[model samples]
Target: MIVHSFPPIIDSGCRMLVLGSMPGAASLQAHRYYWNPRNYMWRILYALFGDGREPDEAYEERLAFALRSGVALWDTIASCERKGSLDSEIRQAIPNDIPGLLADYPNVRAIVCNGSKSLAELTKHFGDHPEVRSRELIRMPSTSPIPTRDYRGLEDRLEVWKKLLEL
Candidate 1:
């Protein structure tokens, strides 16, 4: 079973949380979030915060930059059975304790779901709960290299993700 080993990079200062469906193969192999060179999650963040300098090249620095900027990274699935890294292949998925984290981080003003699966999981866990439904849920395109008909490249996807760090 593949499990999310990356702990939530959240603190009381966290104003936004970006949730991915789960770590892709490269990320899980490297024990880092968004490890794939083609993944634009880091590149988008760098553009928004680091002035377009290379950020993912330094693993720890990238994470620090996220936390320092009041953004946190995590996955919706705590563990799952999947032959590959694709979310479509995921099975027996166990969701993370998003409600608990939301309660712990009262400073969180918004939740930016990085993909459709992440948003669906949150809706599954907290759809009827007033506390969770109250917050703004900004669903952005997945940063995975997996291409969809709507978004072809990072630039197309980056424009949609800009609101995640637009504090």
Candidate 2:
């Protein structure tokens, strides 16, 4: 199966860009980033910036919240062939035009990769680009529901994700 990333959720005021490797099956079907309820991305964001409540269920509201927090969302892979939602399954990945987006949005001062895969892809494709190198680059643990040895609990992940507040 082939998957394609959505257009960036961004604005001129955005100072941080969050990049995922690609949308999972649920996100693709729902036409929204991190649509999977099990994903920790929304929860983490809400906890960090919202009024200590659960994230709004509406997609537009979530985007608005991110933008208001000076954050943007995108993916490293524009398109790829994959059997499942796992980044490990992706093949022949084509990177998104990150440099072009950075050129257009000069206010974006930091790029945050949601997982190892996103960081690896970003480095592979844009490591040398001035637009990428000149800004802060961060790699956070994957917010996917899948468990990892290092980041098994939401609190553990949240602890690291809290760094975004400092940026």
In terms of TM-score, the best-performing candidate is: 2
Give the clash count for model 1: 0
Instruction: Kindly list the per-residue Cα lDDT of model 1 for residues 35-151, writing each as its tens digit.
Output: 889898998888887877877568888888998888888888888887768888888888888888888888888889998998988788777766577678889999887789999
Q: Model 2 reaches what TM-score against the true structure? A: 0.98
Model 1 residue 136 distance off true place after TM-score fit, in angstroms: 0.8
Candidate 1 accuracy as TM-score: 0.93
For residues 24-136, write the lDDT of model 2, one tens digit per residue.
99999999999998999999999998967899978999999999989899999999999879999999999999999999999999999999999999999999999999899
Which regions of candidate 2 are displaced past 4 Å?
Answer: none
Task: Give candidate 2's whole-model lDDT.
Answer: 0.95
- Lowest summed-lDDT stretch of 10 residues in model 1? 1-10
Cα displacement (angstroms), candidate 2, residue 162, comes to 0.3
- Indicate the residue-level lDDT of 130 in model 2: 98
